[model samples]
Target: MRLAILAAYAAVISTATASYAQQSADPSGVWLRDDGNARVRIAPCGSNICATNLWIRDTSKGEEAGDRLVMSLEPKSPDTLAGTAYDAKRDRTYSITVQVSDRSLLTRGCILGGVLCRNVHWQLAR
Candidate 1:
């Protein structure tokens, strides 16, 4: 009975760890905006993922180089991550979803309470 319990507990822990890692697919890469203006890098930072702007053509919208969006995301699907992004520079948090593919990335961000939203597409930067 003791051995059985230990084995079952280990199995449960393994399963949980595996599920958590599912969100760790191929989100790390350098991407270019579909508009041909911005270049960003997405990579793991500490325990979460961060999307940082590498280059920006238009800084009029309060965006600049080195701006980063730290995301705490969960695996909503095999290729999607649903979570919130915290912008430390702006002191704002937004509901965000990231859909990742081999050559494309789609990001949707909405202000708190889902009042204002925007969707942007990015292509893998070679």
Candidate 2:
């Protein structure tokens, strides 16, 4: 019957959605900032992942040696994660996209519905 077919299709869609939600891209490592001024450790932090600052060469702009951005990310692709990042020190949150690679990461964060955005590049620490 037509209704039965539609129901089956809906169930399949639901299952796929759930599966996608659980899948995540891996962005875990020690990374050096693009400017060579900072390094961060990205690893599992509770149920989400976090990028915590390990060191900062220039820490004048309210950036400390231990500030961290806790991220809640879901896989946007095999090598991309998209979600939100919470900066506890600043008490702000940004929508973020992280492109992951074997040796690099390009992270973009936006606020005010993309009115303000910043992209940070990171390389695996040697």
Q: Which candidate is the best by lDDT?
A: 2
TM-score of model 1 relative to the true fold? 0.84
C-alpha RMSD of candidate 2: 2.6
lDDT of model 2 at residue 44? 93
Cα lDDT tens digits for candidate 1, 23-75: 45467899999998799999999988999999999998998999999999888
Q: Which segments of model 2 are wrong by more than 4 Å?
A: 1-24
Q: After superposition, how far is residue 3 of candidate 1 from its true place, in Å?
A: 10
In terms of TM-score, the best-performing candidate is 1
lDDT per model vs. reference: 0.91, 0.92
CA error at residue 40 for candidate 1, angstroms: 0.3
What's the true lDDT of residue 29 in model 1? 94
